[model samples]
Target: MMLPETLREIIIKSGFIKQEDFDGAVKSARELGKNLTDILIYRGLISEDVLGQLVAEYYKVPYISLSKKVITVDLLRLIPEEAATTFRILPFSKTEDTVSLAMENPLDLEAREFVKRKTGMKIDIYYVTAPDFTAALGQYKKNIQDAFTKIIEENVEKSIGKSGDAVTLGADIPVIKILDTILEYAVAERASDIHFEIMEDSYLIRFRIDGVLRDILSLPIAIHPAIVARIKILSLLKIDEHRIPQDGRFKFKIKENYIALRVSILPGFYGENIVLRILPESTRPLALEELGLIGHNLNFVKQNIRKPHGMILVTGPTGSGKTTTLYSILNILNTTEVKICTVEDPVEYGIKRVNQIQINPAAGLTFAAGLRSLLRHDPDIIMVGEIRDKETAEMAIHSSLTGHLVLSTLHTNDAASTIPRFLDMGAEGFLVASTINLVIAQRLVRKLCTSCIETYKPSEEQLSYLKNFLEDSELTHNFYRGKGCAECGNKGYKGRVGIYEVLEINESMRDLIIKRVSAEDIYKEAVAHGMIPLLRDGMDKALGGITTIEEVLRVVRE
Candidate 1:
């Protein structure tokens, strides 16, 4: 049954916090006039969801889970948006004349009566926990999205009509103005990606913020070429090459902040679609502390980086912040005592005393070829950007075995999978096991905005997962959410943080690896030896409200 998971469940499952600790945190929150969520999250309590869950069970009302169900326009219009807003109830569906509304305070007869008076309809209410309700309600909210949406609308008005699928741009309109308007707006909103797409009707402009996209405005079909050309000129992509896909990179300075955009143009049915990845100036290498590597994961990497001759591999999918972690390691090991050389497709950042080379196979410098040339320089350490082929893989292993510490990244699900991947690339199993030191897998999740975070209990499904995972550990249950805020542009999330799991190749691991066992078997052996998985490390951060469980799942679930 899909019943509400309560505070009692949280208390029983956590097996950590007692009634006394709760009372103390509550008292402190009251004394300091601060959010109880803040106190629980920062204090390392399990989660803030327990109290609400307890109260929710105290009242015999069914719990409602938003984002699980669809909210259609017909249902939303049953009650005036104002009445629903006033009563903190979202009327999402109907059966006959009864309207289903989601609210946390189902016991409030006055609020129910108020909603009834305003709508004059039978009210069928389901309880929504605080954070869920706030988030659901935030969708209809207009504070932050409204302001930005207005800017997009104004831009549309300058060129296209309301339903102008067949609209044409005026010749008087400056082509560069449209390009600047979209990019500046995307940057101002802190979007990580911007998409220019061609639909059956018109051109669409969308931006990816906090890992989700929001469609902002449309442009006339006539202006598509000029817009594409403008971005091509900026990225140095071939403008006239409309029949093929092309990739390029350029840095744009907006309001004194340098923004690097990785531009890709692909041919589409309507026109050439362009996608720009916004790499802000902040991609510069961060210190180990800033990379969000905590606990044993941090210490393991620190210890292995000091080793003179071994390979430390960082694994994750594309855009998973793997480069940042590698750069962090490089920064620490960089000193006058040892020479460090890096061969990257595009040098991300420049550090002092580090020789960084851009891998340009088009100019006759592939990873294998450049690495071969780099080895001739007598470097104490080498950083190959990635090991994609057998040649590069063998070369990297050779570098590690031949008394040079090699650091590189691979496209793998986790550290455990990195072993099998290297073997599949034709490296001998013993050779893979002997020279490898540490394998770190990481992902980036959107950080909750402290300025407008909402607190609530987790659902039954969420509680079940936590119980299974935290069964053997100390658990506290206080969850947080980012309610729409003007400061965070209503996305609720403000920034991103890294979650990591580290695997150190010790005697036992090397033995198992030497046997050429399955990745799953090796993974089990590693875990049995107290290797922390990426999910667990991410959960640690989630417990502190540094991130959300939903966001963590988006990364590790893959």
Candidate 2:
């Protein structure tokens, strides 16, 4: 094959291949290496383009080096007229022994050499940027215009008017703009989750705004995998490994504000499904008073928190705002004099003046092992990440009983359920009663969008349900629901508020635990002692229009 002899020698000298290796191998292998091309292919040394050039060179045909040659009208003719016209190269000139061509990118050396050899003339090349070249192309400019028009038409048909205002040219589209628009809308709508789902013909984008899923936009399916990969890459999740589930977190800075994102990926039948949890940089902490505990109850809890001894348990189901409540209590109690230490699975937020340890089981630093070691540090306050097993729970309780004020979280549905959770972890009732100072249970409910809330008279059935849940015989006249509006993205809700149920460990409650009282009975006695249930806190928000009746019903219903 006639590749440029110089280029062939350059390749050979580059140590990419050995001539003896190719020749002997080709001669010996009858089926696999029948030709030099086959030998090169087997060795994976050169591409088809390079082989083609070699063949052209062996035949002594004109060879245009794309990398080193200048672009001229003759080379432009080799390109499809549609592409050449779109790029605006035209008007060739040939004199007796020289060709003077007016073309775009005339400095493209590959184009200049091809033209010089093909026309058999000395070449003079002129260079112009796009706009100047288009203007110089003159009458032949119609060819460029027609080519672009066809591309625009094809792109429009493919896009199916989904983004009418945006223009597309062939396979290349300005996708970043569309992503930005969707993100802006999501932020404006106070969406908690952004869903990008792939379909057969189109990609679907949806926002989980106000606890409801709403479709935002759609695009051609050709772009779905790319967009998905982009999101995965941004989240620092595995992009190339698609067989297993992965979790990742990332933060985005937009307009001087940072947004935290937690991404979870799982394999789906069609492709990977992703869920992005958007956590705003700023959020209000749930204070004890804001949690619907009366002043006396708050004072009691505060006194216990301030005691300098005993463990405080914050118990709730997942996504119940347990971390926020614990952090608030820690913030209240934190001071320069006290040495506070915390071990967390993943430290969500950093608190100044507190030493926080991130628990990594993979590194052999687990909650139980970390807690057992933390006791030696002699911290005034200790925070365990969670009581997943007996060892950690016992260690935390022992620390509290010894002298340190300990705080930790447990997975349970409510305050009363926490006792059983601890017991299930092999904690003795008497030891739990002696060590635990307080238990705070909480849940989050969507707040009614202030921009779109409307007062409404409750139906008898709704009123009856509310009275029974409140345990109040009287029905109040004031209640509200969210009315859809543009400001709230038509979801009638803006944000979320926490509803809490606090259980304080007083002498009577401790004695009841010692007697092995049933969880239901203990709850009843606590209610009698003026402990407000989570349902009441939710009701108060509903009555005040902080949230809607439907939201309270959804969160607090049995």
Candidate 3:
């Protein structure tokens, strides 16, 4: 009898059973019976070995056993010295031990553990060879490389096609293949953004991957307009209408994954300055704790944001991840109980539980106008894409004071800089102080790939720079740097993490704002009140191997 026969008997007794249901029965039997194999065999359902194999498969792990009938010293020697060291296997016998070893696979940790514990001696394990190990390893490596290459090519085709912005060449190699090579290279390098600039004779393509600009391959200038047009088409913008700047957005679906893209086009000296915001499909909404905000700060933000009134502003420069942060917060607060509405220039990501509006300024549905109309619908939480003008800023402030929880973005260097930015927009200090609840200034830095990081003592000049900057503060003597590896696409870095500085306005800060304090002065006070500067936050993450020092310097300096 076999385990399958036992399974069949159980099924027949039950009339019929699904695999999952049968597994449940097996679990119950194991709990109630002694010597599970013997019980099955006595019941005329399974053989000992078959029962053993079933247990192995059920656990999805290799099985190893050492009965005095099946241990061998030659098998122990067959395992590589490195493998033995890793597994902590000790050599015990000069000749083969007559211990029977039963395992689904030789490398099973549980099997090894069982043998070592039962035998009270070290066991050597050997795997069956299939003619050529080196050749197999080589083939596996090549397959991985080829798979990566295919993924890259596929991504390029999807992005280009999504944009509808590349000239198709009906040649042997699709132009998309070249495009995929370039983008895969950029993404693999962990670039923050991709830039395409047109010159006289050539189209210059560069990737701001990892906060550093690297020149990618260039194309002939003749194809510049075609590429631009292709992008315009993909974005759903009118490709022929180039007289005025046009903006559009669309998503690219590749391998059942979707990426959000925002395209902006403006007339340039040589051609059009086109910027594409490539938002990967895998961006998950992180919780406040995950964002590295301290306990007090996290509590403050969550408490205030969860309230029914006031405005929360997330301020940062272009490409500083303001939108992502906003979206993440929105996701946190989104529920069926509240009415949330957003007016974006071009909505970046879709939220299931909120009403989202895309601004069509071309048709006179400006942010201010949209907000005014949105007020009629009675939203509990209002998201203004950006307070770009005095009108929109005034509207956002007024909305906050009118009992709506307003969220918006402002282009400023730091949290305190939001004050000066509002002032520059003709927003009175009193209005700003009254409406503002929280301001989060953030930047994105490229994290170092942990799989390929190297640590060293700081250079004298680097130490001097740090000393000069920190003055009396303590500094770590050693720092880590990224060394390019296959895992990180030879870029040494992987992805980006946020360096955030959150400013929660209390009565004191509001008073300072009402007094029209300078941004630098306000920043000073915020720092004194335990607001971590973006640079310091970046440095902390760098030390933790979350990002590289070079990336921190590049973004913080900017």
Top-scoring candidate (lDDT) = 1
Q: List ranges where model 1 is wrong by over 4 Å.
A: 1-173, 459-462, 472-476
Model 2, range 1-558, lDDT digits (tens) per residue?
223456456557656568876555455344321234434543455553455445444444432323223334444454344434554443344467875554444435666665556667777654333322332333232343344345534543544433321122212253443444455556645688888776655667778865568886665665555555656766766567779988888787766668777777777766766777787776545677665444445666788898889988887777666777788888888888898889997777778888899888988999988888888887999888788999898898889889999999988777887876787788888998899888888777887654345557778887777666654533553466667654354567767767778888888988888777778977997898877787776776675557866687676653
User: In candidate 3, which residue ranges exceed 4 Å CA deviation?
Assistant: 1-173, 176-198, 201-205, 219-246, 264-275, 292-296, 471-473
Question: RMSD per prediction, one decimal?
Answer: 13.0, 28.0, 15.8
Worst 10 residues of 1 by lDDT: 163-172
Error of 2 at 180 (Å): 4.6
Question: By descending TM-score, how would the candidates be arranged?
Answer: 1, 3, 2
Backbone-clash count (model 3): 20
lDDT-best of 1 and 2: 1
Please give the CA lDDT of all the candidate structures. 0.76, 0.66, 0.66
Residue-wise C-alpha lDDT for candidate 3, range 283-381, written one tens digit per residue: 677776556554455766787798787889888788787887788789888988888999997777778878999898779999999999999998999
Q: For residues 9-97, what per-residue lDDT tens digits would candidate 1 score against the true structure?
A: 45545666666766676776765444554465445565435544444555766656764565765666565555665776787777787
TM-score of 2: 0.64
